[model samples]
Target: MSILNHRTVVLDPQFKDLEEFMLSIPALFTENKGVVIHKGRNELRRIEYKGVEYVVKAFHRPNIINRFVYGVFRPSKAKRSYHYANIYREIGVGTPTPVGYMNIRKGLLFDRSYYVTLTSTCPYRYEDLFTHDFPYAEEVLRAIGRTTAVLHEHGYAHKDYGRANILFQQLEDGSIKLEIVDLNRMAVGPIDMKAGCKNFERLPATPEMHRLMAEEYAKARGFDAQKCFELMQAYRSVQPGKIDGLY
Candidate 1:
């Protein structure tokens, strides 16, 4: 951990050598030195340092009220992302390795912040399972279901558990390894069956897909499969908006 000037930087001990590089991201971001992977509410860039590839997420500067809140009371989103990544790692959940996070403060208010993680090697995301006929689709979905149960059992709920945020890789032994991203909004605490089932509401998939996943999740959690499926369907039906004809 290092605090210099108006910037506060915290990095994983393993990445201590990258402190200087991490601190330079805010400046390099302005110069557009990396490949932009996402550009919307937040900007994500794929950048390289030496031979290592990393994804740096530049969080949008908070609004007036939030600036003070994040600066004084709350942890910045980037800091939360970095903190959650380490938790996921300690619990054996799959997520890109977090390198660090940096927050630039102006006076008493928070300015821009960035979260950095090692680039994920997974070639497919959860959306691909439903969009195309990927190999081992059923097995992969079941794996995701079991993984979700594990997350809930561990008291971690991803608020933005959308398709794009879930990633997976096919291993040599034909087993699926699931990974989740977009960590800042994750809620950590005791989770009930209803909340666990409702967590699937953000997934973009068909009813059949949801049922299958719910069943697998129920099996893992020792809950009634039918009830789990029903609860999941109920929550999904009432979601504010639809995605890909389903919610």
Candidate 2:
């Protein structure tokens, strides 16, 4: 989508008075955060003026290579962050609507990189839910699996798939909606079977857990049990390493 695609966006200019736009790339934190919700090396926070919340990403040492590799395919990581904003909108996927992003240059005032998403209430990570008791927990897991397959069928892969990155937004009347939190690494093209499998490989849980997630996905996407297993198996067979990488 075009930069102006959104209804109204307070992009880089919101910080123009405090800082000029540049790609120091790491200083995005100071520019994006008007009020700090919490801070750490991997994730940062900002309270949106509209009373929403957003988690800002700040680059660290370990991810430098991954960020650089992704840049080869995308002009900016911030740009790729919006890839899902379009992807989800087009395909009915559930995720936070990407608000905007900024990449600041090093040596520039408070240089860094960051992107923002319209925040929901205190989001619960998927894995954390398993530690407690909840109804339809199994069904929700399956929903994620089926939802993921739908993404693959449409020609995309969330290379970073795991319970932690997925969040739950509790609704009124005691219901829930799921959202994919991180997107800087999501990519286009044939699903990287290896990367896709890697997503589930970390899910060391009961066979029932795996079964439930896959079942929910198959049911939601109308794949049935057999096809879902085939897809999961196909993904698992791929080696856990770089495939084509991402944008």
Candidate 3:
């Protein structure tokens, strides 16, 4: 951990060698030196340092109340994201390798923050399955379902489970490797059938796709396939308008 001028930074031990580059993120971000990947409530950029590719997420500055909350009582989103990424790795879940996180403070309150991770090599996101005629769509969806089941079984529920957050690639052995990103809002605890089914609400999938994934998820969790499908459909039905790439 490094602290200077009301800014605190914590790096994963494995990435200690990149401390200098990590420390320079605030300046680099302010300079707008990286290629922008997404721009919205928050911003993500792909940057290179010493020929190494990294994705840096600059979180929006919190509101006054939230600044105090995040500064004193709660972890900033960047910190949570870094923490959860390590937890995912520990539990054998796929996520981009966390490099570090930095939190800037304004007086007694939190200001902006950034989270850094190595760029993921996966070429396909879950949205591709819907937009394009992705090869082996059924098999990939099944793998996604199984991976989600594993995630839930390990007591983690992605609060923002959406198509864009899921990245997948096919391996040589015909298995799909799925990696999840944007990890700040995750619920960690025993997940019941209802919560598990509701987790699918944000994924934009056709009814048939939902059924396929539901059945596969049910098989992995040993739940009744029909019940799982129905519950997932019910939850998906009431989901609010698309929010931040979710649908």
Candidate 4:
């Protein structure tokens, strides 16, 4: 691979050797390709490196205009994912630990970028709860609501705060632990009540379910449950599609 200009950040000492392999991403991607976790604008491939599992996300190629724009104006998606993963860790939010990120440039313009993170197998995603009447559904939803409230209170606004992005694992103590993924589409800023409610817009849960979550969020934020539920309903009414880079 011809790396005209490349940058990578390794957060964990255990994964320091992952940096050397960034140069051979093409070969590693081809040799260790596993099941596809997600496939849309970007692709998430589960791969193993020296017996340690990791998820490598390949971002879509940019257009002519975006090549320059991303190369000059903004950090690539890989960099953003790496940046937010550390920030989430710093803010006491749970996410997959970032292994590293790489940007391959062709001359001055950016060619491709990739993000690597440790793979985690949570028992359930919020999306499963929406589709099935799982046991402890209300409790799980409430916990997620409280967790999201804490994130918003700390100024962590997840642009793609949909069901699939939130993962939960049930513990032996009958409590659930939550972790977030697909973290590149996130923002950090002051989040008001309305903005907080809007964050749940993409969750396709029923109105009653949303109300249940609103109660928990209201409790955390000291807001009215009815008002929060109403705002979430209004935001959900628009029903925007999944976030994409072109937007």
Candidate 5:
């Protein structure tokens, strides 16, 4: 049998016992019997541990060539997700609370990895709000705009700031809270006004919605509204493609 190497980091003290369960990530992923949240490049599952629900994202095993490349050149996605979640929290940005992460390797080759986070009850995403009529839609859109602007002000760029990755929760106090997900592609660096405006390239917003977002974003960042809107438009025009029927 090939030697397996495993390492884990648990962020929650209450979930200390979960650390021991990290050893079973490989088996849990292989069993393939959980509420599948996502099933693309990586697989996400909602699992219950002692009645507490959590989401476990299992990244695809690398190919032969990728095994060597990942082992030598970079940290696993699980590691990046864990660290980024912490960074977002530190910056006052919202994301699902990270529970832990695990990296599995066979001999010297990178094999599989998993990222676990607490399950949240955010049933609405920016996608839903954009595509359907909802109460206080304008307020929510402006809030999203402000949130994105604040994210940029903090020098964080979400590589995939698509609507689906931005989740929303309506609190009992009648306020909305937004959380960003799919964080492995995020980066932290100094962001200029133009670059920050370009970050909206993937959002599916109508021209009127774009105008509102641009106004709010510019106001928050103290940029010229027209200039910011133009910059957003320029970047959006060059997007690989748009999601049809979303605007």
Candidate 6:
């Protein structure tokens, strides 16, 4: 039930004159020794070049339909991830700052996926900081709750709202900065309290942890606990059977 209050428009392929972007690579990865920061089955890679970080998201799809869908309907979650993060940042929240990124390409030959601006400092995921104490944990959660409220208030819905989509950043003072990632399936529509509530409901719902998260979120966002309770209960009534291959 994600709403798309804002339509994240991606750069059209027609506007991509590859020759112009490729020219900048010579001073980065080519002459410098960049190390891998992160890697995934998504074929997305983050590399450090010339003391700066860059994310390169690659896709291996020869299917024309895949290309068409990627180009139009479902834009790169990579870029959307940044856009949402920036939205959070502008509102006194902590999100990874995006510099700018090149559209994923293999030199001047073919285009693959979109590369997002990389963060040299943020944690890969919230789980990445399980061992360490994130000082701004409460602030981070409030920030998250506020972000969720903001999205709903703005008429946006996210395709994935699980734990993985929520990432943590360890600032210089050891404070945790929360950020959302993996955008691409956001939608635009009038707010349906049900859909937004279902997103929070479909979360892990740990016996203790989720209860605490809900309480914290309620307190942080100044949302009524009873409202969230009704929403969760209503959403649970129409639960689906099973969804496999959801990684």
Tell me the whole-model lDDT of each prediction, alpha carbons only: 0.86, 0.56, 0.87, 0.81, 0.80, 0.51
Superposed by TM-score, candidate 5 places the C-alpha of residue 175 at a distance from the truth, in angstroms, of 1.4
Candidate 5 ranges with C-alpha deviation above 4 Å = 1-4, 7-10, 240-247
| Backbone Cα, N, C clashes tallied per candidate | 0, 19, 0, 0, 0, 9
lDDT of 1 by residue, 1-247 (tens): 3233388889899999998898889888889998999999999999999999999999998899998898889999999999989888888889999999998988778888999999998889988876677868888788888989988899888888998999988899998888889999876677778878888898866777878898899998999989988888888888533222121
Q: Report the C-alpha lDDT of model 2 over 1-247, residue by residue, as the tens digit.
A: 2322211222433344312222322344445645565556556555544344455555443355544443333345555666566677688778776656664332212223466665755457788766877675765676677667777667776666665667775567655577776676766776544444445654445656666766765565455665555555555555544435543
- Comparison by TM-score, 4 against 6, better one: 4
Error of 6 at 238 (Å): 7.9
Order the candidate numbers by lDDT, best to worst.
Answer: 3, 1, 4, 5, 2, 6
Candidate 6 global TM-score: 0.62
Better of 3 and 4 by lDDT: 3
Q: What is the lDDT of candidate 1?
A: 0.86
52-82 per-residue lDDT for model 5 (tens digits): 8888988898899888777778888888888
lDDT of 6 by residue, 84-122 (tens): 656655655444555433334332222344444556355
lDDT, model 4: 0.81
Q: Which tens-of-lDDT digit does each residue in 1-247 have in candidate 4?
A: 4456655444467777777666667566667567788889988898876888888898998998999888778899999898888888887778887888888777678778889888876868988985666687878889878988988888887888877889987778988778898888876777778878888888887898889899999999999999999988888899664322222
Candidate 3 lDDT tens digits, 173-200? 9888889999999877888777788888
- Residue 109 accuracy (lDDT) in model 5: 86
The 10-residue segment of model 6 with minimum total lDDT is 1-10
The superposed Cα distance between candidate 2 and the true structure at residue 221, in angstroms, equals 6.2
Clashing pairs in 3: none
Work out the TM-score per prediction. Answer: 0.93, 0.66, 0.92, 0.89, 0.90, 0.62
Clashing pairs in model 1, backbone N/Cα/C closer than 3 A = none
Q: After superposition, how far is residue 170 of candidate 2 from its true place, in Å?
A: 5.1
Model 5, residue 236: C-alpha shift (Å): 2.0
As for model 2, its CA RMSD to the true structure in angstroms is: 7.0
